[model samples]
Each structure stands twice: as C-alpha cells, then as structure tokens.
Target: MEIELSLPEPDPAEQDREVIETLINDSKYTSFAAKYLREHKSEIDQLIKMKTKFGNTWKDVVKTGLRVPNSKVGFYATDADCYDVFGDPLKYVVHSHNMRDADPNAIPQRVVGGDQLSLQVSDACKERIISARCRFARNLTNYVFPTSISPKDRVAAEAELKAALDKLTGDLAGTYTKMGDLSQEEQDKMVENHQLFHNKDEFLVKGDFYDDWPNGRGQFHNNDGTVMVWVGEEDHIRCMSLEKGSDISSCYNKATKMLEHLDKHVGLAHHKDFGWLTSCPTNVGTGMRASVHISLPRIKANMPISELKDICKKNNLDIRGTGGENTGFAGVVFDVSNRRRFDVALSRCHY
Candidate 1:
C-alpha cells in the first residue's frame, strides 16, 4: 500500500492561502466552528475579499465577533491591532474590562453566552495587570438622545446631573468641578484614575456633541479617588470607579454602591423591559464597563502585531488604547474589559 502516485505542482497563488479560507473550508472544524462558518457567510465573504485585496485583520474579526451575547459582527477593524501586531515602537498591550448594555432593536442581540471574546490585550498584560474599574451610564427621562438634543436641552441635562452630584456628598464624598478648572497636575492625576476624558466620543461628535462645548460638563471623584462621576460627557450621567489592583470584589463594590446611591437620589432613566437606556444602543443594559490597565514589556519586544492579536483573541479579551478608539497607543497602557453585556445576569459580570 506504499504506492507513490505523481501529483501536480501546487499553484503559486494557492501556496500562501488565506487563514479565513482555512477556517471556512476546513472539514475538521468542531461543531461550534462549523456552525460559526455557516452562520457568518456574509462576513466570511467580506473577510475573504479583504484578504484577497487589502489585508485581513483576524484580530478585529475575532474580537468583535466572538463568544458573547449580541456579538458585533461586521465590526470595523481599527488600526490599533495592526499597530500592536507590528509592535509599535511607542506602545504595548494593557488589560482592561467594561460591562455595558443598551436597550434597542437596531443592533442585533445575541443569545446567552454567544460570540464576544477577544483576548490579545489582556494576555499581554496578565503579569503586569494592575486593577479593574467598573462604570455605568444613565440618561435622563425628559431629554432626548444627545445626538438629537438641542444646545438648550444639552445644558438642561448637564444641569440636572450637576444637581445630582450633591446627593452623593456624604456617601461618596467627592467634589464636582469643571475639567478646564483642573490644573495640569490635577488633570494628569485624574487620567490615572480613569476619571478624565478630554475629548468627546467620535459618535458624539458626528451627532453634534460640541454644540454647547464644555459649559455644563464636569467631573466628580471621591476623597481617595476610587469613585468618579461624569456630567455631560457622552451620556447625561456616567458614574465610574477604578481601583489600584485587580481586586474585582473591591472595585465592583465601589461601582455598584456608587450607582445605588446615585440611583436612589437622582433616579436613572429606565424602561421596563430594556433596563437602562443609553444614547448608544450598545450601552442600554447594565451600562457598566469594568476594565483593568496592564503593562506588557516582553510581549511588546517579542511578537508581531498579528500574532500577538491572535493570542489575545484566543484567550477571550480585547485591547483598546489608553487614549481610546484608534488614537494610537499610550506607551504600554491598554484598556482590557469584559466584552459580554447581554444574556448574562448583570450581577454575574463581576465574576
């Protein structure tokens, strides 16, 4: 049975085949992967086209479309992963997590524990992992979405949140002040606390968030700097708290308590079925984004961006830059956060 039959030479074009093709065509796929291939046919086509024409971003595909509820398939790839894979001279991966939910129908919601894990950033920063921050947002009942709201309404909503800060005076122990008033050192201090957001989110900009400027915008942090509240950032009220180490118990306690106190005092807008409603449909549920900042010196020195990203995705985490959303790296600081928000109980997110 050791017969040697002459075979045709391999085609040069097929020699370096795309990984996507292997994923789609391989019969050795497990039931999960096989079902994945069948369900994401259109996305697969897009990936193949990218591979054949421009370049393929396996990290983006996996991170945005992996194991989680309401997986964001067709997620636009960011150049950040490309930079990470190429080992950008200026930055390295960091780990952070976020818990968020949105109530709406435009974006498809996934079943319990569906595709939503991307792990490159978290793995790179595992050894250097520092701490986790948990946060959430709530919009007011009267005001329309920030995108559609007039300048007058924006100010009104901002004023409302500013008033709510007082309700937290004793329990949370923080002062409310404008960002511009904070000096350079103070601003830098806030940055480390994950309490400072200098610019507006891009989605907000396209929706005309700058119409009223920072007139009503302000930040609040507790004495020890573990708690924070953003008035007039992207949402009407965004409460956040970040701890110094990966102590989920402590971090979650501060975050939930902050929300609990604020909700009791100033009532977060909510719908019966949808839970918390945010400006972005993506953040309608728990509206919590829990993340940790980590440093990855060795991974920065050893791997290519693509392979590094691949490792992270395999591990079920996501890597976003310090400045956030494609503003380039922040040296070695990265935000690694939980990607699943729907299907799972909000309480379970801490686990």
Candidate 2:
C-alpha cells in the first residue's frame, strides 16, 4: 500500500518566502533540504501546506536545515516525506543512495548475507581493520514512525519488544535498560564505548523524535555485549552486532539472528517500493550499514581529505570518524562503511 499524503490548499500568508530564500542563499546552508527549497522555490507554497497522515509537514521536514544551516542530511520525519513533500527529487535521491538511477518499475528486495564461517575482507586488508560492525534501522509494521508516535503507543511498542527480548535464550539472553533508569556514569560509559544512543542529536530533536524524553527509550544487549539493540531511537529499533577485526560474517550473522528472532515475535515493516520502511528515506532499502574501523595513516598522510572522499565515492564506500556520521576522523583510524543503502542486493550491500 502507498503512503498517505495531503495536499491542502496553499496558505499565502504562511509562506515565509523571502526569509527562506535568504537562508537558502546563505553559504553555510548546504543541506539537502536547503538545496531542495532553493531549486523548487515555486513549490514552497504547496510544500508548506502538504501534510503526511501522521501530520508531519514541510516545516517538520526542513526544521533541521533551518535550525542548523550546515547540517548534512537536513532531515525528514516520516517515509511519506520523500515522495509527497519533497517531490522525490530523483536526482538527489539517486545520488544520495549512490545508485545509478531510479527505475519506476523496479521493486528492490532486501537480500541479507549472514554466513557465520566466512570473512568478507582480504587477508592483507584485514591487517588494518580494527573492528567490524553491522547494524540496521527497523520499525514495526503497525506503528507510526518515532517522530509521530504518541507516548502511549511508544510505551506499548517498547513493552512488546521487551517481551520478545525476554524470550531470547542461549547467547542472546541479556537485559533491557531504560534510559530513565541509567545513572550519569552508566550513560557516560555507554556513550564512550558506543553502546548507547543519546537524544541530543540536533537533527532528530528538530524532527520531534524525543517527544517524551526517555519515557519509552531503552537498549538491550546480549550477555557478551556483542549483539545489541536500541529501542525508540530515530527508528523504532536498531539491531546491531560488533566483532573485533574484520569478521563481517560473525557480525552479520549475529545481527541477522537477533533481527529474525525479533521479526518472529514482533514483525518488521517492509514495502515493495521501500524494502524496509524507516524514519528517513536514506535508509529505505536494506537500512543496513556494515562498517569496519581501520587505521589509514598512509592514505591520510598522502592524500587530501577531499581526494580520499572522492576515492571512497568511486569505490561505493563512505569514510567517517570513529565516532560516526558528521564527525571528523580521529587521527588515522576511520570508520569505513557502505555508501549505497538502497536498490542494492542486501547480500552485496554489506561487503
């Protein structure tokens, strides 16, 4: 089924034409939202009036860019924002996904590769690889995106996930710790170790993701901490697996196993047009990001950051700081991950 969107009559007085025009013209404003608004000035009126079934409007979609002119993604509250409010912007979408083109008739399906005994990297490349991680954003088929989910429903969703997690046995047995129950020290350690998520992200904050603070937000990790999941983040759930060195197979296998268990109990949302529905369009397809932390001192020393970025683009890889997206690399250690998240075979997407 298609997403629902409303095109209400444009309100002239609500159009902050000159104000938006000025921001779009600012050199610091280079996010996707800014670019879209600048190029489609005429659609501002319609965009302002457009609303998703959950009541997200253009203001919700572009607030990130307006609030932080230098924001990378800008942001979108729901899946419908991609086609309904943003006009699809085929060029931008395809480019963002690092795909060749968008074929209207094509229905891309997700194909995951989770071999437990295989490694994805070459022996030589493995030397520089510090760790491997696999994670995917997921939402429930019956629930609205986090940005629009009511507090009561959000709590219900978390309870449902907790029940499913409680059923996990063997290596997957663990605890679900709510953000509200975490102490300052506990939160700090998790953040330092990259085991927890914070609600302070400007983009998500502007998108209205942390409505009731940490009421329904929490995280679950296996006894060993290798396999984990974040509940009520940007998406309804984010399943992850981490392994030392370049063990893609183990990472993928563990994450996929947890995801399958969750799916068996709580059903994940999926669509023909968008393999896995998510809060943001960028993660629509597989919604998976498989990455490796590696030391690249030689490359860092010899090539400029811009040149290295171009090379990464050519190779369908994205390099970021060890801290994650929008952060700068820490010395020579960098997080290298797949750039194409949509329209690609999931099996191949991870490699």
Candidate 3:
C-alpha cells in the first residue's frame, strides 16, 4: 500500500529578505568576512544536499539493524560565531524527527539512498572541522595584524578570537578523549546493542551493504524465516539508535571529565583564574548558567499580550517573538539554573 505523507509547507511570507541583505552588507566589511561567508554559503548549500542523501542512507542502515523509536542523529554547530553567522543560534535546540516518524514505509528510494546519507554525515562532519579550522585561523589573523593598529582594539579582538578558539579546541579535544578512553567492554556493549536485531546472513554479508542491500532480492527477511520480509533488523547508519537525553548527559559528562583533566594537567596555579591573565569579570569564577531553547508558540499567539510577559519576568526567562529582533523564528531563550562550576557531583546525581 502506497502512502502519501503530508509535509509541512514552507511559508513564502516568512522569508526574511532584510536579514539576507544585512548579511551581504556585513560580509563586505572585512576581506576575511567576505571570503569566509562565500565559502560558508557554499558549505551550507552542500550540507543541505548531504542531509537529503544521509536521511535515506540512515533509513537503509536502520532496516538492516534494530528498530528503536526516537532514534535520531544529526550534526549541530555549537560555536557562538557560527551561530551568529547562521542568524539563528537557538534553532539548534529543536530535535529532528526520523523518516519513520514521518512515514513508516519511507524506504531507500533512488533519491534517498544509503550512499547519500553517509555522504551527508561526512559533509556535516567536514563542515564542523572546517569551522574549527577557520576559527583557529582567525586567531592567527589577529596575531598577524600589527600592534601599531591601536592596542586597545587589537587586544579586544585578540581576546575574543582566543576565547572562540579555546572553546572549540576544548570541545573537540574532549570528544576525542572520551571516545579514545572508551573501554573494549564498552565497545562490546554497543555491538551487543546492534546485535539485538541482528540477522546472521544479512549482518555477515558485508560488501557495500548499504548501496546494495536487498538489491533485486525484492524483500526484507527476518531471522525466524517469516515471509514478513519487512522484518529485518533496523539499520542505524548514523548511530541514531541511542537515546537523545542520554546523549545530552553524555556530553555533560565529557565536559566535566575534560575540566577535571585540565585541572590536573595544568594544575590549580596555572588555571587559578581560568588561565586568563586579564579575565572578563563576567566569566571570573563560574561563567554564565546553562541556557535552554524553548518554544513559546502560545506566547507569540497571545502577545503584546502581557500575561506571558508577567510570567517571563517572574521566572527570569527571556522572551523574544518570532525571530529575535535581529533574526526571526529563533524562539525564546530560557536560562537553566547553575552557572559554569561544572558540578560533577550534580551531573552524576542527575544521571
């Protein structure tokens, strides 16, 4: 039975020509900005194309593996500068739904094939790596610029660039460290999880499995030999089978672990004031609290709309309508309690 899924239609009216114009204007300011944005736009277009491919690849991978509801995996750029450049930093907060959620029979078709999906993931990973490299290069740019160009302005720019590079480096290093430290037992556990829906024949026949799965065989099969060919293990090409909440917890865990490692490696004296010789007062001890992205659709519907405004004031949550003044549709920003202390104990307790 063929099913036609109803997809959300794009709103032409919602497109912000002004923001695009502003970005074009902003790009003209610095040679770096102009060159970087040109490359960024190209990368973004490639990312969209890759996403289309990866979406299909992931579906095929799941079909050959285990099926789990709420399984999702997508790349998110976490840097502040990228967020600003993209025009909506908070949009990353929304979770992406899988094809199965949208359409159960959404199998690997010509356009949405496994190869495309893998390519998409590769492209996204590449984009992230490129973004980091660009940030690092920006620091070099600042250093290359002469000290004769106003010490105060140069110093401020240098500090900003350094902070951006440091955060990116720390995050990348932390992820690698966590992955490298994973025990053999832990790796086995992941395999075991995959084996839950394992079919010996299919799992073992591993020659370009993604592109050629079920080729002209014309049907999916199960381990028990049921004619229900749509019964093979769910393919998880991107490891979306894992729980998202758990993923967030894992990220928090890694951050704390890295901080602990840094504390030990650099020693207290070295990082007494977070290694900043002239530290920003705002980030002195524990920096800003964790910020959460929340959808306030109801607030938008009822606004100028003082009722929600009162609530926001009482709760200390910042509310912006539609697009934040600068960028539309970015949603509201809600601050999570607890500043940057990286309370390992609290994180553990929550876990």
Candidate 4:
C-alpha cells in the first residue's frame, strides 16, 4: 500500500496576530517596539508587511531587542523608521533622556559654529583631566544608513567623503586608509592608539552592520592625529578631535571646522524634527557625544562605582570606562561625557 501526505497552507493573518499578541503581552520584554505594537493592534498587518526603502520591515526594527532580552530602547534601521513606524513609542522612550514633556515631533535643529571656547574647566579641575575629546556622528544625505546600506552605495558614499577630505588645507591635511588594506600589525597599532573601530560590539553585530565587512570602510586623520574621521563605522561618519589636557575648546573647534566643511562639500542628513538623520533614534537629535578622559583618583578612592554612577545620572552626565562604553575604567581614570544628545543646546554645554 502507498501513503500520501498533505499539509495545510500557511496563514499570514494568523501569523501576524500571533506576533502582535506575543510581543504586546511579553512581561519579560519592555521596549518601545512592544509598546508600539500594543497601541497599534489594528495596523498589525500593515506594519508586519511594511518595508522601508532600505528593506527594513517592522520585524527588523524589533528583532535585536526581542532576541537580546536585555537591550534598552532597542534599535532602528534608518531615520525613516523612527517617524514612519516608531514615532509615538519613541516619544515615551526618549523622555528618559530628560526630555519630559518634549514633543518628539519637535526636536531642535543641528547647531554648529557656536563658541566652544566659551566654556572652560576651572584650573583646579583641569589639573585632573588627562585629555579632552569632542566627537559627533553624521550620515550622508540621499543615502541609506549603514545598518542596511547597499555595498554599491557604500563605495559611492566613501568616494564622496574621500574627495571632500582630500581637499583639507593647513593642519587638516591627512590620509584616508582603507580598512581592508591595513596589515594586522597596522590595524593593532590603530586600535592601541584609539584611532580605529573594531567589530566586537554585540549591538552592531546583531543589527547586521558588519555584513560585507570592511569592503567600503576607511579612516581619515589629520597629520597630528588630533582630528579624525571614521568612515563607514556604526555611522557613516564619526568625526572627532582630541588633544592632551582639558582644552576641550581646541577639540570642539577642530571638529566644527571639519563638520562645516563636510556640510558644505557633501550634504549631511538632517531631519526637520530630529537634528540629524542616523540609523538609531537615540542619536536622532544632534548626533553628538562630546567626551573627555579625566582622572578622578580622590573621588574613586572615597566613593563606590555605583554611587558615582548615581551622582553622574543626577547631573545629566554619563561616566564610562577608559576604553569607552561597556568597559571598565583604567585605574583612577574615567571617561565622563554629557548624557543629553537632544533638546539641550550645544552652546550651553560646558565641562
């Protein structure tokens, strides 16, 4: 005797409803993605099938947080997804950034050319600061972000930035080195000097950022290495300036010059409600993270790390390890930076 097997057809309607209900009621999961899904139950089918130009569906936006289990705020595929898919959810989420009562639809515009020198660390505090660094993130206009940028578009974008960087004059003159071209030793040296980015980040890994790895990525730094730009890192552009001591003004000014030059030569992505268009909504406004590596031996000796963290939180500041985020501090030295990326004016930022 012969036997035949039959299988029932899959149902998208049933699948969509299950996805919505599961995420909405998941007590262990708390993120903006789940919040949005619960509030928009009627649009479950539309969201399930919706895809941005960069091929980011609602699934892509929430997968990292849902899978990681401990992720905060989750992640975004592109700037468009924030407004088109997760706007209201983000309004509640960003409130944690001290943006209480702020309209997520009315983020301030990008502010540059401010008097960076206006704010100076007092002489006593300056004595403990090892170095100062000011860095900001930027993405190119008319291009998808790094999270889902096509390999072809990646090369084209790099070419555009390289052309503009090649035109730097005076102290800004520097060389752009392709990541794939660097030897292992050379790569190690760059990492040691903190001039290169690595692919060890779990958040970036889960987001598919390292796909087609190093195919169209590079770094550009000025002759003195004070000014630098990481091309095709987490963001399309990671522009920064660093110098010894607490002369944050120098770092800020150098970075501004580079930013203004890029803005004029190659357009930058800017959102009307969000200052800058970036892959992540957390960096939507300003896309700036100005930081300094400071030594706080006395404070460290007296206070526990948890207490220090609480104090930093109270003052609208963030404290990181010497190696940067997700790492521990080196000896008594720490990386102290502003916590507010949006709503706060750049001109008002003082160390």
Tens-digit lDDT track of model 3 for 1-351: 999999888642232222223333553333222223334554433222221111221112122112211212211211122222332211221111111111212221211011210112244333222110000000121121120123343334334432332443333321111222345576356346432122233322321222322221111112231111111112110111111221233333333333333233322111221211101111212221222234444555666545655665455433333221223344443222222221122222111
Tell me the lDDT of candidate 4.
Answer: 0.76
lDDT of 4 at 113: 58
Instruction: Name the runs in model 2 displaced over 4 angstroms.
Output: 1-29, 37-50, 79-99, 103-117
Candidate 2 lDDT trough over 10 residues, lowest sum? 107-116
Ranking by TM-score: 4, 2, 1, 3
Candidate 3 global Cα RMSD? 24.0
For all candidates in order, the CA lDDT equals 0.53, 0.76, 0.25, 0.76
State the lDDT of candidate 4 residue by residue for 1-351, as single tens digits.
Answer: 999988998765566556667778887666666766667778776666665665655556666766665667665556454455555555555565455665554464555655455465799879888998988888887677787778998888899999999999988899998899998789879888799988778878887778778877899999999999999888889999999998887888889888878888888877665666667677766677778888888998999999999999888789989887789866999998888777655544432
Give the winner by lDDT: 1 or 3: 1
lDDT of 1 by residue, 187-275 (tens): 67876755676554444454454456656667888878878888766677777777676664566666666666666655666553345
Cα lDDT of model 2 by residue, 1-351, tens digit: 999998998664365454467557887887776776777778766665667666656565566667777776676545433444454542364356454665434434433334343655788888999999998898887676787788998999999999999999998899998888999788879978888988788778877899998888899999998899999999999999998988877888888788778877888877665566677767767788999999989999999998999988788888889887789866999898988778765656744
Over 4 Å off, model 3: 1-249, 268-278, 303-313, 316-351
Which is superior by TM-score, 1 or 3? 1
TM-score to native of every candidate shown: 0.58, 0.81, 0.24, 0.88
Q: How well does candidate 4 match the true structure, expressed as C-alpha RMSD?
A: 3.3
Displacement of the residue 185 alpha carbon in candidate 1, Å: 10
Select the stronger candidate by lDDT from 3 and 4: 4
Q: How many clashing pairs per prediction, in order?
A: 42, 0, 18, 0
